[model samples]
Target chain A: MTTDTYQAVQASNINKRSTRWAEFLIQSGLGLCALVSIITTIAIIIILGKEGFSFFQHVSPAEFFLGTRWVPLLEPQSFGVLPLVWGTLLVTFGAAVIAIPIGLASAIYLSEYASDRVRSIVKPILELLAGIPTVVYGFFALTFITPLLKGIFPDIQVFNALSGAIVVGIMVLPMIATLSDNALSAVPQTLRQGAYALGATSYEVTTQVVVPAGLSGVMASFLLAISRAIGETMAVTLAAGATPNISLTFFESIQTMTAYIVQISLGDAPAGGIAYQTLFVVAGLLFVITLILNVLSQKILMRYQEVYD
Target chain B: MSTPNKPAFQLDYGDLKRRHRKAKIFANFCATITWMGVALLAVLLAQVSIDGFKWLDWQFISSFPSRFPAKAGIASALVGTLWLISLIAIISIPIGVATALYLEEFNSKNRLNRLIELNISNLAGVPSIVYGIIGLAVFVRQLGLERSLLSGALTMSLLILPIIIIASREAIKTVPMSIRHAAFALGATRWQTTWAHVLPAASPGILTGVILALSRAIGETAPLIMIGGLTYVAFFPEGPMDSFTALPIQIFNWVARPQQEFHELAAGAIIVLLAVLLLMNAAAIVIRHKAEKKFK
Candidate 1:
């Protein structure tokens, strides 16, 4: 081979090596970001687990999980999670009640009946509501919702579970509407046509055909919304009052598990105090619950294939 | 002819249709309820805008809070929000983008990577408040970063991590696989094909997703509240260790006060927050639009 050709070949080989090196750098950079997030999750789990384990070592898991009373700040404290769980459930259930009917009705109107002009104007507004901070909802709950509820239920507390639940319902309403609309829109046109061709009324078509077809997506959206409500903290802390009471009535103030975590953290619990460890144990429980719900929702979405291509 | 004779009005199709149309008006009335729901949403925006705007004065924008609501400005709050969002974007973008690229390009559909993929989807649904608790337990208490902006940002980063990854994946997936194969056929390494050919092509989509996630992060108050953000930080945070306040937190504080004047302050703060959020979202929409045209 000519010397010139040999030199050119060597230069080309160097060029390929550098190109490969550059490629590796780029790919690694991208991979590292994802790896960091996964690591963060693992780190959170390990930290929470260690703290919770130590906590359970001192206070048995049985009492923590099943004890009816929750008095963590007392001397020889009771670490029962039941009261907190009950409050969380009550508030979440209340929110779900308020959110489902209103959100579903509005979604039906938007997807089935509303004109394009109405849709173009309305969708963003609901989303904007969703974007408003939970703190604002807390304020709204405390100042507006509580007062409103008080006028009707004169015996109700100033800061009650009902107020928090209502505000949370309003907060999650947009999520439900948006997701339900997406689900309703995904219902095939042929299905609706088939119902209509059988001399079904518009209401019948909606109730019997569109809703059933979109059930899984709708269900998944509700599950996601419920998870959101369950994990809500700031609003509950601000509006639902700090008392860890086990009550089904919305008029009474109650503390959720999240609110307990927030409350203890806000207080001057020494860095390694049992009080602080309680926050982690509760947090760990909250994490597992929300994670399970989320995974289940994802499974539902996958099973139904309700999501359109 | 076999049927009995009918009235002249019934004989015409237009008349029969008109009667049905009258009944359809009832259905249309039901349609109006949807708009009413939309109207309720409008009322919320209007209330926030009008109320939030009432408090938007120079002092409100420039000064810190005093005993009086009229005295407080959002200078620290605004700066804190900006700093937090910037850090969050900086930390989150590279990792989220990379994860998306790895999953989209390099990772075969093996069980391990698929599990990772499923994990990402599940993580996206984990509530924001749960992440707040995580941040408090792990970063604030364990890491000894007590209520600082860094801890808050890291918490927010985790809160939105799943969203960023999912959006980035969508962007990467939208890049036709043919481009990757073509680059490989040209003797390009997997890294070369992804870095040069795939990433640029998918940049716009990824950028849009990042912007949306960041916008959501900027608006969040729950996790920040749990992680020890103060409602009243008169002086701006000079460092990561310094306690900080955010726009939402400031707004919440103002709104919580019993005094009516504070409501105006809350409204003003809301306007500022809304403006920032809208600007980010608008930018994302514009970028996504440009990407749509380019790829098409």
Candidate 2:
């Protein structure tokens, strides 16, 4: 063969090789990104697990799980998960109580009643709330919302669960509304028409028919909102008063699992100390809770695929 | 689930009248609250503006934090924020976009690929603070990067990676498959077609996704704080390894201070953050509008 033909063949071969290399790198890069995500999760679990296990070695699992006290770093290391859990529940419950009604009502109105112009304006504004830093919300809750709450409830603690709950509820409201609106919008217009044709008013049709149809999405949104509330740290740290007390009253000071983690991290919790261990253990538990809720939402999405699509 | 077999053939006069009244009241109540939701946003904005506007002069923008509010400005913080965001975008966008492209165009129905996809989706919901821990351990301690802009940027990139990947994947998926087929029929290689034709078509969408991702990153404080982002920097960041302060961390620090004046500075920082966020979002909107027009 001539040198020219050989050069052409060589060029073609080089091009083919480069193409294959490019394909491999691209595919592998995707796999790597995905791997990074999984590795991050696994690393969290592993780190938290080892530290948490060590924590339990010092304090019995039964005491950690069942005991109603939590004062690890003090003179006596009383490691009880109950107070923290209770505080978490109180704030989360408060948040949910505030968020559910307002978010759902707004979502219902936006999806069912609002015009296009209203939606275009309202959705972005709601998203702006979501976009605000939790720290800023913390400031808002501490400076503005707490004082406002104090005016109404004289006995309320200056650093109380109510303000945190209220701010958290407001913080996650946009998520709930946005998700619920998407869910409601996914319900076929035909379904609404069918209900209306049966002489059902818009209200009856929306509450009875559409709400049920969008139930899974609404449920998923609720789970998402709750997880957001549970995982929230800065806001609770600032507003909820990092006091890990066992109290159910909304007006009392409390600390969540996340707040505790931030509290210890911000302080001088030494490496390998029990106080440090508590952070990992609580983080592990928080991770599991949020992960479980997330998995459930994904399952709901898959199961409701046919209904929505 | 039994469907109602019979419509109320005779609209019961008294029952219908009572139901209509209740429905009207409920619907109107919902409408009022939806309007309330919008108004809440307005109130928040108004409060931020009223508190922050006085402090937002040119010198204030250029000064560092001082004991006196008048002498303090966010010049260093603003520059540090710009640097962090720029680094984050540069590092993550190509990786994110490439990942999305691979998932959309190359990956087959294999278990590993599916597992990866599932993991990405799950990662999207992981709290930002968790990513902070991961960064501290993996990037800072293990890799010995220290608490610097690079580590912070890496942490943030991880936090928003799933978002960028998802958005980019959605964008790439929107590209018509027929375009690929047509290119292939004309003897274009997969790389050629993807690079020359598919990517350009998907550019606006991918750009919009990146813009949104940056918008979220700009507002994020939790992960950065966890990664030990400097809250008070007198000078702008010189390199990736240098300690840096960004808008959120600065705002957090100022807000945490007891002084009422510092609180005003926090609000001022928020206004700046909000302005940047709004601009990014607006740009994304414009990109989408342009894409729609181009496609039309």
Candidate 3:
């Protein structure tokens, strides 16, 4: 071969190597971007573990888990986290009670009964509800819902569990409605027609054919919505008063786990103090419960998706 | 028509009637619930508007918070939100989009990819306050960013990254695979194809997602509170390192107070917040509508 041709061939080989190198660089760069999320997850766990473990050094597991009356910032400070957990559950249960039937009904109406125009309008309105800030909901709870509740029950506290539950329920409603609608709609149209042909009424078709077919999705939505209610902070904090009560009374002031986090956060708890440490412990518990619910919901959702798709 | 006589089987009129009635009642029940939901939304809007309409004046818009409710305004809160949002947008968009690109276009479902996907989902499920906790520990204390706008923005960016990545991935997926094939059939490289063809095609959908994510960040007070961004800042954020207060934080503080006037101020701030949210949502919806229309 000529020397010039040989040099040209070498240059082409060099060019191809550079191109491969460039591709590698680009892909790794994007991969690094994806790594940021993993890094975030690791960071969350480490921080929660690092600071959260210190809270345990002061308060025993039995006291933190089994004990009642959480008064971490008082004269005789107690570290029992059960009151906060109970309050969280009380609000979550109340919110679930408010959200489930109504949200499911709306889902049924939208997916099975409503006209397309109605669906279009109602869906956006529901999205509007979802888009409204939790802070705004907190404001609404304090200013509107509590006063409204107080009218009927004259002895209700200014910050009670009922208004918090109602608002949180409202917050989670759209999730249930939308998710269940998707689940119900994913059931084949032919199944509905078959049910109709078999002398099933629309109600029968919806309850038996549609809902059963989409049971997992509906379940997942419920789980996820409830999980959301568990994590809801501002609304619960504002509506439910900071007095950590062990009882499940809707009329009384109560503090939730989330509310306690905010309470400690808003206070002048020094970072290394037991008061601040309690914040992490409570947050760690909140994280675990929510993570479990979330994982279960996703598992259910994945199963449903696999079945449908 | 003459063959429609009851020849095959006997029809139970009473049972059919009962069933029809039950169906009608159930349908009506669901309808009532839906209408009630719509009505509740209307009531919420009306209540806020009524309470805040008189309070929302020029003075309320331009001043800062005060011990006296009459002197408190949304100016600092508004500026802080702007700074936070702008910073969050800048920090999150590139990382989110790049991650989405990696997941959607650049890789197969390898172990690392699977881990990333799982991590993102779990992160998405993590509560906002938990993100705030992480922010406080990692950003505020560890990195010594303190209670600054940058810390708040970074915290929120982490909180919303999963959302942005998921949405962006969905958008990128909608860009037809054939587009990639066509680019590769030519001399274009993978990066070139994604950058030139795929990104533009997916830009509108990506934009809608970005706007919605940003709107979510706007209203979040929990994580910001955790990171100490809920301070009673009287001045606007001058830089990324400045301590700031967001609209929701301000509204939260006011609503937390016992005074009636502060509650009214909270109501007014809610109005501003809702208006901003509505605008961002409208922009997102319009973009989506236009994109859908282009296909039709």
Task: Give the alpha carbon lDDT tens digit for every residue of A136-199 in model 1.
Answer: 6776676567878889999999778999898888889889988989999899898788767765
- 1 or 2: which has the higher TM-score? 2
List model 2 lDDT by residue over B1-296, tens digit each: 44588542223346887888888988899889878877777777787788889999998898987778879988888988899999999988988887787777777878877987898888888877777767776787779998899999999998888999999989988899899997665555666678888899999999999999998898888778877645668987899999888888888888878788988998898899889988888899899999999999
Could you give candidate 3's per-residue lDDT for residues A167-214 as a string of tens digits? 999989999999899989888898788878878888888887788888
> For model 1 chain B, where is the 10-residue window of minimal lDDT?
B7-16
Q: Candidate 1 lDDT, tens digit per residue, B182-225?
A: 76655556876778899999899889899989988988886887
In model 3, what lDDT does residue A35 have? 94
Measured by DockQ, the strongest candidate is 3
lDDT of 2 by residue, A1-309 (tens): 566865665466446777678766756766676566667668877877888888888888899899988887888668889899899889899899999999999899899998999889898888777877788788788778888998999899988999989889989999999999998989899888987887887778888888888888898899889988988878887898979898858888998887787667666466677776787787788888888989988898778654543
The DockQ values of the predictions, listed in order, are: 0.33, 0.44, 0.50
Q: For model 2, which pairs clash?
A: B63-B73
Each candidate's interface RMSD (Å, one decimal) is: 6.3, 3.8, 4.4
Model 2 spans with C-alpha error above 4 angstroms: A1-18, A304-309, B1-14
Model 2 chain B: worst 10 consecutive residues (lDDT sum):
B6-15
